[model samples]
Target: MTDEASAFVPGHVTGFFSVERTDDPTTTGSRGGGLALTDGVRVTVRPAEETTVVLDDVGVEIGAVDRVLDALGAQATVIGETDLPIGAGFGVSGAMALGTALAGNAVFDRRLLRDELVTIAHGAEVQAGTGLGDVVAQAAGGITLRLEPGGPMENRLDAIPARSRVEYVTFGELDTATVISGDTDRLTLAGEEALSTVVAEPTVSEFMYAARKFAREANLLTAEVRDVITDVSAANGEASMAMLGETVFALGDGLSSAGYEPQVCQVDPAGATLVDDRDVDGEITGRSADGSE
Candidate 1:
């Protein structure tokens, strides 16, 4: 078996989404539009006596990651790193699951096809209630339009085929399960309107406009994010709130030009991919430390 393997999965931020739920986990996901960021997660899998999961050096019990490992039927040490904050609309949980699946497949010689691996990770996310379309979006990259709601194999997706400099700042996190499990009729309706508007135009500027409208219509934007968006817009930059979190994302150098020191990254065109692995002769030097996800 390979000594270890690594994979990089992009962080995703949903601009607007319509919830779609079903009995089958594989068929359950969200119909949404979002951007995959270059500032994302990188995961490495190595053989270990027992299963262990760490994100940013912190050991966290991620149910989705556990489900992915269980599906692969392998116990290994997984180390994930990302500057993006989890539960703040950055798709950290989904990224970790997808990254682990990609790396563990090679580390354990599972040989699961990429599609199958994505489905596994997507299913895990859905079942765990950690995410819906993020795994799929992170897999596709760029500005993704989730045309249909399902796992990777069961879903339909398209991208804007464009890229831009992305900047973001998070005020805090939101409980996704609390929001998605509640009455989504209003949210869904507003989301559909926003999605339609973007689908018609399908440009970065339009996307930001539609997202801003969706946030207002759906009543999902926090005051802090709202102020941030206003600031960026006043600076003549496109900005909007990220769905399911108190995050403000802007195109180009909106945040910087607005005098906000937000994290900066670009739209990741490649999405998730496997990085080079370490050989048995050496070891992966990502030391385990205490931290949060």
Candidate 2:
């Protein structure tokens, strides 16, 4: 095993989702559609006397990350960096947990498969209540459409099969657990409708249209978010709110055309991957996190 290892996990934004909760965390997940952005988390791992997690230069105790270490039976200093706003529907927690799983597995010589690492991280997020669908979507990458819920073992995933530049602007944060904890009757119904609509013609425009409809029917949009969407539509752009966050995302140059300077990135087709590894000898030329060429 190397003294240090690094992994990169793309950030995921769920446009709309339907939740399914069971007693088992492994089986609990969400059915949704979202984009995996190139703007994501980069995690570095090194052997430490004790386990710790730091993000963006600040020490933090992320529950899902801790749980991943426990599941892997490994301890290390995990450092993560990302520009995506936390609690703003960018799936930062899931990215951290999943990144740790990948980097930790490598650093500790866990010898576990990448799918196993993904399940470990996905389960940790479900147990911590920090996320539902983010881990799986981030793991799969691209414009993701989660057809079935649960971890990699029990879930079915599809994508929009197209690519484009993604644009996003965030207004503020939303409490994900609070919103998802109560009465998903409305959310589930709206999400199912949106999922079906997108499934019929899995296109970027269709995804945006369904997500906008879900945001309206689910009644989760803040005034600022709604206004931005209205402005973007008025400018003849397809835009939608990121589910569970007061963030708006548009495809292509939608936000730019609408006079909003949004953070721009391309869709990440290659999900999570090992960036590099290090030992006393120098860099260890590594393969993908999944152990593929």
lDDT of each: 0.88, 0.88
Q: Which ten residues in a row have the lowest lDDT in candidate 1?
A: 284-293
Q: What clash count goes with each model?
A: 0, 0
List runs of model 2 lying over 4 Å from the truth.
277-293
TM-score, per-candidate, Cα-based? 0.93, 0.94
**Pairs that collide, model 1:** none
- State the lDDT of candidate 2 residue by residue for 120-227, as single tens digits: 999999998888999999999899999999999989999999987888999999988888788888898899899999999998999999999999999998999999
Tell me the tens digit of each residue's lDDT in model 1 across 91-202. Answer: 9999999999999999999988999999999999999998888999999888999888998779999878788888899989999888888898998888888888888889
